[model samples]
Target: MTIAHSLGFPRIGKQRELKKAVEAYWRGKLNQEQLLAEGQKLRQQHWQWQAEAGLDYVPVGDFAWYDQVLNLSCTLGVIPERFLADAKQIPSEVGLELYFKMARGDTNEQGEVAACEMTKWFDTNYHYIVPEFTENQSFAISSSQLLEEIKEAAQQGLKPKPVLLGPLSYLWLGKAKGSDFNKLSLLDELIRVYGELLVKIADLGVEWIQLDEPILTLDLDNEWRQGFETAYNRLQSTPVNILLATYFGALGDNLGTAINLPTEGLHIDLVRAPEQLTSVVDRLPAYKVLSVGVVNGRNVWRTDLQQWLERLQPVKQRIGDRLWVGPSCSLLHSPVDLNQEQQFADDVRQWLAFAVQKNKEIAVLAKALAGDNSTEITAAIEASMAAFKEKNNSGRIHDETIQARVQAIDANMSIRQKPYNQRVVLQRQQLKLPLLPTTTIGSFPQTTAIRAARKAFKAGKLTEAEYRAEMKQQIADAVHRQETLDLDVLVHGEAERNDMVEYFGEQLSGFLFSQHGWVQSYGSRCVKPPIILGDIKREQPMTVEWIRYAQTLTNKPLKGMLTGPVTMLCWSFPREDVSREVSCLQLALALRDEVQDLEKAGIHIIQIDEPAIREGLPLRKAEWQQYLDWAVRCFKIASCGVENTTQIHTHMCYSEFNDIIEAIAALDADVITIETSRSDMELLDAFENFEYPNEIGPGVYDIHSPNIPSQDWIKQLLKKAANKIDLERLWVNPDCGLKTRDWSETEQALANMVAVAKELREEYQAS
Candidate 1:
């Protein structure tokens, strides 16, 4: 019989119980024992749910207090030298405290320490802690977290298949610290530790281990490809079966290497690249199990069971009992439960599936493939077919007017009226900004009082007028703080907005909101993304009133903040019925209207953030141009409809822009700000190498960490940035928004930032 299983499940509970519990521990509201209890409860509940959904094996070692990648780092004893002291004390004293320190940084007697750098996980919005490496990196089985979790799962009378991040992929996901060296050189040592780990896991009576190596989807050199063969060959001696899993994209050229590996089984994602099914089935060994991921894991849309059955039946016929069925990737990218969304329209609700629903979809497929076509299984297939049919043919999804507007877009709509050099001169003459102008990336800290007001307003406990007054007061305070610091550019603080994307989606047509749809972005940070159901259109100006009100409170040039078209689309659960280019264009047109309105409202500087643009790039380099072409065009369409005197700015955070520097320049914004402090000004190398035109703000402060930077520290970073880019074109700002930070740290950090700008300005004049 075919096996049914999952790559992973959402660690955040249905109502975000993990987030609350973890945050409470951070704030000293809960002790270590209490926090451990909460994590244990969430794990048991998730395992039980998967078992009830008819999974053949429950996934252990997939649960993490923070992130799975970070957990693996701990297990491998890959702690950076900065956190070595904390690690030494972990065996006897510290428990998961050292783990949280590696993730969130710490301020103690050892002085302030920055956390390991983080970046996007593949193309999804989920963020993972990037593993740090050194030239002489050593590996040892340091933590027993995975071993403990396996025993815990086995105690519950469920078959636990441990999921481990494959050795090659773990090294590939990491960066070489100190100096440049081939990370693959450490592969031999890494495999030794992995071999030791497999033996211990097998000793626990585990039958199968899911080893994920998603890097097979990427273009690899011969050295990296050979390293995979070498590593797996060494690990094949372990007395356990290894199911090599790859997802997020198709394994194109690496298919030969992957199939030849000495693993007992291989998992392929059929949702993203179903075209590879025939090729894989033809080449796969007869003795090896082929896990077919037929259910979509990265999306919310319900799968069409009839269509998938047609696709999977041919593969099942070829492979017979060796076939397995599951989700395309980890359900960690998806929300917890669809049943929690009680506020959604019935039609809209029927058209969606969260993590729990997707698992059931996997089970139903497994039964159908096994020829168990009971009435219940047949009804599930029928319901899935009906939901998809209704979604495709629904009148509410198609708007003739919006479609016509998207069709009518022309080349002229995407080009600026003048070039950057000419526009910069006009912007400078009008605004009269300083040399090293200091500003924020919009959004002051979202204080508890501010959240309370928004919650009260939503609950109808406070009237709209009362809520507006509360927000206006918060905006006023933000403006006063910036003016006192003598920062050159100002933002409205975004006090009235809940989320950058959700705020706009709430006011737009053809969008659906969820009451409990939340997914983790990083540590303890969760975002409830809006679902784009149909053609997008703006009914009225989204940010004009709040921005205009903010401009009235400050003499400085306040930036009109808007989330860019690509980010708005990428961050949300976009429409699957239409092409992404079409949906992005429709969103661009809607934002185009808002951009013009912000200009009319007398807001001179506008910042449209496209942080997710880099995240949205296709995994395959061959397919990048198609995505970049439309992505850049959509951004231009939204931002180009403005005067030369109106300075347009864009901000990107926690992304590697080296490969896409040309595309970044093509956006043609007057100024661009990016996250740099966490990488210690490493991202600036890309802009310098490309001789990127237009002004820039290389963030001098790492806002993600709680540790505050001294004024001197900020000055040194700015000086380092000056060495790469021209001084006149440089601006000063933080790595990203301060919404997640506390007001106390936000104020002190901005003060230090402004002080650095002043010290640098005087030094440049003296020189």
Candidate 2:
């Protein structure tokens, strides 16, 4: 019989209980015991759901209080030295505190420590804590969380399969901190820890272990490939049967090395690269189990079960009992449950499936493949087929006017009227500014009163007029604050907007909102993304009124803020029926209309953020240009409609631009601000090497951490940035928006930021 299992499940509860509990713990409302209990409850509930779905084995060790990668870091004793005074001490005593501190920095008698740098997980919106490594890194089995979880699952009478981040991928995902050296050089020591970890899981009576190595989808050199072989060969000696899992994209060249690894099974993602199925089966050993992921894991779209069964039939025939079925990747990228969305249209809701539904789909696929022709199984297959067909042909999803507008897009629409050199001159003449001009990334802190008023307004406790007054008051306060700081530029503070993307989606047509569809973007930070069900088009100006009001309040140039087309698409659950290029172009045209309106509204500066553009790059190097070409075109379409006097700015956070510096330059915004404080100004080397023509704001403060950077510290960072790029074209800003920060931290940080700019300006003039 074919096995049915999952790579992982969404740990955030259906109503986001984990988010609430974690936040409560951080705020001192909940104690450590209560937090651990809450975590256990969530883990048990998720495991029960998987068991109920008829999974052959319930996956343990997938649950985390913050992130799975950070959990693994603690499990393998990879805590950074800053968090621990003594390197020899065991971390488990202060495990939870150490973990939270590593994720969100801490300030104590030991002064302040910055958190470990974070970045996107592959092509997904999920953020993982990037592991920190040094040349002399050592590993040991520290945290007993995974071993304890396996026992808990076994006690529940469910067959448990422990999941772990593969050793090779863990090293590959990390950075070399203090001294530069090959991370792979430390793999022998890392595998020794993994060998011990596997033995512990085996002693817990676990029969199978799923080790995820998603980096196989990326281009790798011979040494990294050889490291995988050596690591797994050492790990294969453990009693537990190993299932090597790869997802996000096709294995391609790595397929040979992956299959040849001394493991009992291999999992391939057929939803992304189904063509690899035949090739994988042809070369696989007959004794090894081949788990084929047929259901979509990264998306909410329902799988066409009938079609998938047809595709899997021949593969099953070749592999017979060795064939297994699951999702394309971990369902951590998906929302918890589709059943919680009570507000969605019936037709639209039918076309969707969350993590819970996806697991049931996996079970149904496995049963059908095993020739279980029961009435219930047949009905599920039929329902899935019907949903897929209706979604494709639904008149609600297609709009002729929007389609025509997208089709009418021309190359001229994607080019600016003037290049950066000419445009900067016009912008400077139009709005005179000083060297190292200080600005923000277009949002002030969203405070408790602000959140309360918005909640009250949404709940109908306040009228539209009353709500507008409250938001206007907040915006005026923000303007006064910026004027007080003596910053060069100002922003409307985005007091009226709930989220950068969701705010725009609410005004646009052809999108669906969810009441309880939240996914974790990073630790304790959950985002409820809008569902893109149909063609996208803007009916009216989204940010004009708020921006115009703020501009009137301040003598300084206030930026008109808008989320870019690529970010709006990549961050949301985009339409599967249309090509991304078509959907993105449609969004670009809509945003283009808004950009022109902002120009007309007397706004001199506009910032359209494309943070997800780098996140949207294809995993395979050979396929990157096709994605970059369309992504750049869409951004240009949104931004290129403005005049040279109207300075266009863009912001990106927590993304590595070294490989895509040319594409970043091609966006052609007059100024670009990025998150560089966490990486300690390392990202500036890319812009400096490329001799990027436009102005830039290499962020001087890390807003994600609550630690207020001192004035001298900000000045030193500015000095580092000045050495790399010309100070003439440099701007000063924070790493990202201050939406998640409190007002006190925001005020102190901006005060220091403005001080750094002023001091730098006077010093440069004197020199």
Candidate 3:
């Protein structure tokens, strides 16, 4: 017999019930009890949905108020002493408030400590708070969220496999506090805490535990490699069966070390690197199970059932009943379900499967492998095959005219009109401005009024003319505000956009969207990425109307905002049948036309944001250059079509870019803005080492936090930035967009930012 299971489930809820409930609590609309009840309801809904799909084992501990890694950090009592000390006087029941404070800092009568720094989770777009460790750090089992969730799953009669981030990976993903110290030095104490947690799980009488150690797939040294051995070896005494899982890449040379662990099973991500299977099957131990992850959890494309069945048949024959089949990673990265995507057309809808449908596909595959070949199982396979065939030969998949243009592309389309040196000179002459030019990264806050108007328009409560008038007023207000603030460059405020990528996708051919298919970009931040199905083309002007209108209002020279091709493809779920390079090139071609149109509309400074380029890089160092080569090319193709004086700018956010400085230079935008405020000017070292020639805006304010920086603080950051960059090349801006921020804070923060820039200008003049 074969078993079907899930590594994890999406926590944002089907219709975004969790997001609404959480936001309501933050807004003081709901009490703590109300919010807890809502979270409980969402967890039950997700678990029952998976159980109904015939999964043998459903996962618990996947629900997070903010992030899963933060939950683990809090549960293990690895929180900083500052938060614990702050919570000493608070009531015991409100201890979870400390957890929330650690993830997103809160203020009271006492002094405030900022929230822990956040970074990209592995190579994915998901953000996790970095666990801070000190030399005297200690660990203990303090939180009961996991154990309580386990008991709750038992009440639902579902066999719960509580998922925990493996200790090795958790330690590897974190950083040391303030000073340089070996983070792995605290591994022993961390394993002790895990041992205690496992003992409790054993007491609950749970059968299997899923230990996610995704970092094992990365390059490891001798000490860190040996640390994995020591940690799991200590946990071998636990009664619960351990399923050590590795995903996002292959085990590669670590296969021997991984298989040799004294555990019940080892799960490998075959969806990413299928070639690792032969070696995994060969090294299988007789007494242990071998879980093969054949289904994709990150993408929305329907699994090729027949292809997966063929690959797993031989494995089932070898491993017999010990095999457990599931997604290659957690379903947390995917949308909730395909059935919720009612907005999709029939022709395109048949080719996609979200998180819920993927579970059913796994169940069907397990039955077929177990030789239970019922008519239902046979029909599922046949339908999947038909969907694949229809999607392959669809007339919408290609455009001969677009293909011809792409093929005829030469050196001219990929290169700017002038190199950085010549272009900067021409840009300065064309747009006379101050030394420290200030601008926002293309968007202002999307207020409740804007969201309500968009909702009304979608629901037919308002006419098209009414919607246009309202959004235009919002843009006019944005222009007026920028003039009041006296900023150098202005944006159209993007009030008409539901999202940057999705808005452009709505104007282009070959993309589909959902009313409620929201995925978490970070804490309380959700994005609905359009699904790219066929060949892409700009049917008409996407940004010209709003940008042209805003340009009329501001003599500050409006910066035409657009999401770059690489970011669009990286953010959206591209078709499974196409290579990313091909899909990206098609997107680039579509944007090339948009770029030319925006220029013709009298927009001088166009900002094409590519924050996802670093997120889309391959995990392995050996494969970075291959992916970056095309990614840079795609960005260039999208932004390089205009003249030198057009002044193209790009923005990157919330990433460690030390490794990709050359690729950053390769995009060759006339100006670039990066998120450096959170890291305290350390990110400038990359630009300093590269001696980056183009103008730069090292963001002076950390946009992610509501805690505004003082003018003195901002000036200090600028002083540090001056050491690395030339005075003429420096610009002033916030780290990213202010969409999530409210009007009051946005005004206060930008006011502080402008004052900081003026003070810096005074210093430059006196010198």
Candidate 4:
């Protein structure tokens, strides 16, 4: 019988129990023991759920209180300098405080910490804690989390296949505090620790361990090849059957190196990079069991069993007896079970499948290969094929009028209405701003009280009218506070929104909001991404009421905040039936109307953020331009309809900007704000090199932390920014929105920000 395995499961639980419990603990409502008990119960339930789904190899150690990478950091003693316990004598006690500190970070009673530096997890929206390395970095599997999980699963009569981030990926994704990218000296020590971890798991009688080496998908040179060899060699002594897994892209020449790595099993994602099947067949070791990732993992598309079988036939001929079929990667990205969606149109919902339904896809493909002709499986596969035909080439895809309009747009559409010179003259005169204007990235702190109110409103304790009144009050107060602070710009504080994407998704057509769909975007922070079910259109204005109302409250330039079309499309669970560009354009046309509405509302300085722009880039460099072209076009379409002096501003959260500077410029925003404090203004280097002409705000302080920055620190940042760009074009602000912070910090930070901006204005004028 073929074995079915999952690389991991969503840890947030079906109803987001973990998120509730963790937040409860942070609020002092739950104790450490209560938190641990909740975690254990969640893990047990997940294991049972996977087992009931008929998985042969259920996963363990994948559920984490914060992040699995942070857990590994704790186990390996790679704790950053600040999180390290000061006394050192009670090193064993450091586990609890250190882990939370690494995640939430230690701050005053106001909630601050030395914020953890977060980075992208292998091209997905999910973030992992970037491992901090020191010369004194030590390794020990201190926690019994993994072993306990395996033992618990065994008690439940399930054989668990534990998943681990392979040493190569772990080390490759890490950074030394102040070292060059070429630093490979830490690799040797990191691998030694990983080898010991393998030994520990083997000692616990764990037979199959899934070692995910996703770095195989990246552009690798000779150095990475040697690093892989050294790492796997040290880990080879363990009796555990290593299932070496690679996903997200094609293996190419890395296939030969992977096949020779002395692993007992090799897993390749035939669903993502299906061209790798030819290579997998050409280079299989005699004793190796091949786990073919045949089902779609990253997409919402259902598998065409007939097409999958065509790709599998050649591989099955060589290794049929030793073959296993599964999802191309973990089903964590896909929503929970499709059976839970009751509100969707029956026709559309019938054509969809979530994680639970996907398991059936894998199982049916396995049985079909084994020659089991069950009617249910056959009917399901047939329906999927029928749906694919209906949806892909459906009448819903193209609008002749929309297409004509898009085609009619010339290069001038991408250019602003009037040149920057004329627009700035009007904007400055209208706004009457001094040098070094101060503004925020368009959110105030989302406090516990506000969260409770929203949660209450969601549960129907508060009516729609009541909720709006409450949110309006919060917005009114936020605008009132900003005016009192004498800030140059103001925002509505966005207390009305639960999420940047979900807020707009609620008002848009063709999207479904889940009652219980929660996925971890990072440590302790979960997002409920809206699923696009069919053709999308705007039913009504999304942010107009909030923006117009907030504008009524303030005399200052109240910026109308909206999430751009490309971001709304990228951040949501997009429709797989059509090309992404088509879906993006659909959203762009809708937002274009909204932008015009906001301008009509008499709101100036409209900020449309595209934080996911970098996250949406294709994994391969050769294909990046195709994505960038459509992405920039979508953004331009959204912003172009507004008149000159409207002052469109775009904000991007933490990302590497050097590679896409030209594309960023193409967005043609009057101003752009980007996270720069964490990178030490290195992000601005791209603008300097590209000779970017637009005004810019390289964040003066890191918003990811609670560390209250002094006025001097902000001044220093402004001074450094002034050195690179013209001082007249600089704006001062934090790296991101202040939603995750407390009111005290938010108030103090802005007050300090304004002070620093004032000082800069005086100094620049004198110079």
Candidate 5:
């Protein structure tokens, strides 16, 4: 029988119980035992769900409390000196916190510790905290989370594929602290660590390991080319069969290198890079098992099984007995299951397939190829065909009117009503701001009461009027607090939004909201991205009521916040039928109308966040411009229609803006805010060197932590930023929004931020 396997499962629970439980543990509300129990429960439930969906090889060790890359760093004992020094007796909980801090800088009572820098994970918005290594990086294989998970799955009579980050991908993704990338000669030692890990798993009686070397999809040099063969050759004697899984893009030049390696099995992503199959089939070694990634992992569209079957035919002809079927990558990018979406209209639902549906597709494909001519499989494929045809014929897509408007948006249309030089004078004059303006990043804490009220309204427990009254009261109080604190700019505090992207997705056409589709963004933080179902169009104004109402209560310049088209399209599970550029353009057109409406409502300043813009760039440098061109064009289309006096701002979080400064500057916002607190204003160097001709707010504080930032800290950051950009054009704010923080921290942090700005202003005047 042809077997089906998964590279990994979504670690986030269906209801996001893992996020809540982890947060509870961090806050001392829940103990370690409780955290562990919750994790185990989630893993068991996930395994059972996949098994029920007919997945033959459910994966273990893919589940992580924080991140899989961080887990591998721990597994290899590559703990950086800083984390090791600060953590005297680090439990896994504290270890996890330190890990996240490395990925996204942290500020607590201990002061600021830079987050481990993050990098793109194969063109996905999902970020892995880059592992920091040193020449002295050692091996410590103490964590048995994988072993325990495998044992648990076996206890339930499920034999599982133990997933691990392959040695080459792990080392390639890491950097050595205070050392140049070229100087780190740790490959030999790193291979030893993996050799040790493989032997240990062999001792645990695991039969197969899904060792992910997704970097095999990228362009590589001789060093990485040499490392692959050297490491696997050393592990050839290990008892476990290593399945080297590569995904996210094509294996152009890397295919020959990969097939030449002495691994037992190879998994190729035919979904994204299907063109490479002609070469992949020709080059595979007779003994090497091939797992064809036929089903799409990153998209939500239902699979066309007939098309998939045709592709699988040639592969089956060559290696029919040895072939297996799987998803292009981990199903983590997709939602957990379509079974939970009870509210979707059947027609819309027919066109959709979540992670669970994708898994079943793989199983059915595997069985059909194995000569099981089940009537259900054929009928399901026919139904998918019918749905595809219906979607094509609906006239919902291909809007000539929208395309004409988009094509009409030329250089003049993209340019704001006023250029920066003029807009600067206009904005400073209109707002009557200081040299360095003080503001928050558009949201205050979303309190339990606010969440409860929103939930009550959604569940029909509270009337719309009651919900609105409470939300208005919350907004009024937030505005009053900012007023008392003497903040120059005001926001509605985003009390009405469950999430930045989801709130807009719920209102916009061509999108579908998931009731239980949740994924962990970071430590204990969850996001449910709206699913793009069809051509996107805005029926009416989405944020007008909230922004207009907030403006009524405040004389200050109220910044209307919207998620940019690129971010909305990037974050959501987009449809496979449409190109991302097309989807973004559709979202851009919808948001353009909203921008016009916000301006009409007399909102002078608007902040459209494109945090995921960098994530959407192509992995290869050569292909980056094409993506960035469309990305910037989409942003311009979304924001350029407003008047010159209307200041447009954009924000990016946890980004290293140096490499892409030119492209970012090309976006041409009047002012931009970015997360700089983590890097201690290291990101500002780009602006300084490039002489970026726009205003900026390098974040003065990190918002991810519970502890407040000191006035001294904010002062230091501002002083650093002032050296980089003109103090006249600089603004002071936190690295990002404060929605995740508690009331005490948010109030204290903002107060300190304002205090720093005031101190800087006094010094400028005195000088």
Candidate 6:
């Protein structure tokens, strides 16, 4: 029998109930019991949904309060010593405080302790806690979260395949802090703990366990590959079968290393590397089951049912009962369901699928292979095939005139006439700025009042005139507050905008939005990325009025905030048939028109944010150049038309810039600000070592959390940043935007930020 399996499901509830509950806990409105209960409720709802959807293999232990990696950190005793009661404690009363501390970091009412470092999770928008290890690291199965979740699934009458990050990948993903050796040196200890956990699951009569080793997709050294051999050798003694799962990209040479492993089953992502399947089928051991990841997991386009059946039929015939159909990776990357997006046109909506819909795709394919040839199912399949055909060659998706314009793009269109040295002189003269000028990233807090007014306007309770008046007031207040805080550049606080990217999408042609099509960016943060339905163009100037209004209130340079082209593509659900590079070029042209409008409207300083740029990097090292080449090209198309004095500023969140510092320098912005507070200037080493040429604003304080940084602390961080780059090249700001934070923290953090800049200037002058 063909079994339909899901890698994982969305943790945030249908209405984002989890986000509300988590935020309430952070604000002291909910206790630990209430929060835990909410988490349990969400887990049950997700499991029941999968089971009812007729999925044969439902996943357990994939649900997390924060992140799956952190959950794994808790299950195994991979915790740093400070987070636990005792250094040698096996399990000393694990509570909510201990778990939350490791994620957001602990700070007293007076605010002191710093957050642990966090970075991008393998180029995704999601952020994961960096596992801090030391020489005295000890391993034990400290917690029962995974075991208990497995038991919970059994009680719910579902066949649970417990998913775990493989020991090799876990050790490989973590950082070795204050240690002189490789973190993989402790791989044996970690594997021992995993083996013990696996034995306990087998004791519960669980037949299969999924060990995800996504690190196989990355470029690995021989030692790392050998470490995999050493690690799985220990796991061979476990009673339960190990299903080694790998995704994100092609295995290439890693295919040989993976198939040769001593595991009962192997799962490879065919949606990304469909070419690998033929090679695997030819060389497979007859006894081992092969799980084929045929359905797309990371995108939104509807799978062509006919094509999927054709792709899977041959594999099912070769493997027979050993074949399992599944998504290419976890559905955690996809939205929950397309059914909730009722606001979209039927034409566009029919051509899409979310996580739940993806599971249905798996089920339909599995049943088709099982000889269930009912008319209803056959008609459904035919409809999906038709939708794919319509979407692929739809006139809405492409315009030949736009394609011609894109093809005609020249070298001169994507570059500034003056170099950074020359541009800076003109900018300094025009702006008359001080050393280490301070600015906010783009937005201020979009408080409850702002949301309420916008909601009222949308629902027709308030008139458009009234809403505009309220927004203008908010903008004036934002300008007044920045002046009182004594900052350099100013922002409009984005009072009229809902999101940085979504605001632009709403004004541009060829896009559709959803009423409830939200996907999780990270913990408790859900973003509804607009669906690109056709070729996009700016109908009119998107932000000129807001920028012009904000500038009229300030003598200081008010930045015209815009979301860059690559970010627009990376953050949104782009059209599937169109190549990503082509879609990005179209967006670049739209934003190019907007940029020129802003410059013409007397808004001299423009900050086009590409925070999603690094998150869009392909997982494999061999593939980075191709992505960066087009990504850089699109950004230049959006930015380069302006004069030198009209400074271009860009912002990136907490990501590993060290690997792509040259690409960052190539953007050639007048200034760049990045998140460095939690990483504690570790991110600045990339800048210092690269000798980054453009002006930099390495953030002085972390803004994601509510923790307010002290001016003294900010000064010390600036001094640390000065170590890597010349002081003249530095700017002062918070890590990211202040949108998630409240007014109190935003005000306090920015005040300290400006004061730090003043102190640094005085110190530099005196010296």
What lDDT would each prediction earn against the true structure? 0.91, 0.90, 0.87, 0.80, 0.82, 0.85
lDDT (10s digit) by residue, model 2, range 427-482: 89999998889999988889999999999998999999999999999999999988
TM-score of each: 0.98, 0.98, 0.97, 0.93, 0.94, 0.97
Model 5 lDDT per residue over 1-767, tens place: 78888888788887778878877877789887878899999999989888987888889988888778887776666666665555443344334555555544655556666566654465776767778775555656636566677889888888788898888888778766675554226777777767777787777777788899998988898777877888888878777899999998888888878998888899999988889888987889999899989888887788888888887877787797789999999987877888899988787778788888888888888887887778987777778789888877866556676667656666765667766888778777777877788888888988999989998998999999999999999999899999988998988898888898998988887777889877656656677888887677788899999889999997889999999999999899887776899889888889989999999999999999998888887766778889999999999989999877889999998765588999999888998999887667878888878989989988888787555778887888889988888888899889899898888778888889898898889999899
On lDDT, the stronger of 5 and 6 is: 6
RMSD of each: 1.4, 1.3, 1.8, 2.9, 2.5, 1.6
Q: lDDT score, residue 151, model 5?
A: 84
lDDT per residue as tens, model 4, 1-767: 56777777778877778888987887789999999899999888888777777677788878888888887777676777665445543154335656777776566543333567776677677878878765555665667677778888888888889888888888777776755545467777777777777788888778899999987877788888888888788778877889999998888768778889988888888766877787787788889988888777765556777777666766677777678888888777776666777876655665666777777778777766766668976776688778777767656444566556555656655567887768888888777877888999998989777888899997999999998888888888899889877889889999989899998888877777775566778766788788776567778898898889988876778899999888898778877666788778778878888999999989878999998898888777878999999899889988988878799999997677589999998888889999887666878888787898889988988876657877777777788899898877888889899998888888898899998888778877997
Ranking by lDDT: 1, 2, 3, 6, 5, 4
Q: Which stretches of candidate 4 lie above 4 Å from their native place?
A: 87-94, 108-113, 135-138, 374-409, 419-422, 447-467, 688-690, 706-719, 763-767
Model 1 off-target regions past 4 Å?
Answer: 86-94
- lDDT agreement of model 4 with the native: 0.80
Worst 10 residues of 4 by lDDT: 85-94
Error of 1 at 435 (Å): 0.9
What C-alpha root-mean-square deviation, in Å, does candidate 6 show against the real structure? 1.6
lDDT of 6 by residue, 166-224 (tens): 88888877887775778887887888888889999999889899999999988988998
lDDT of 3 at 722: 86
| Candidate 6 positional error at 490, Å | 1.0
Candidate 6 lDDT trough over 10 residues, lowest sum: 85-94
Better of 2 and 4 by TM-score: 2
lDDT of 6: 0.85
Highest lDDT scorer: 1
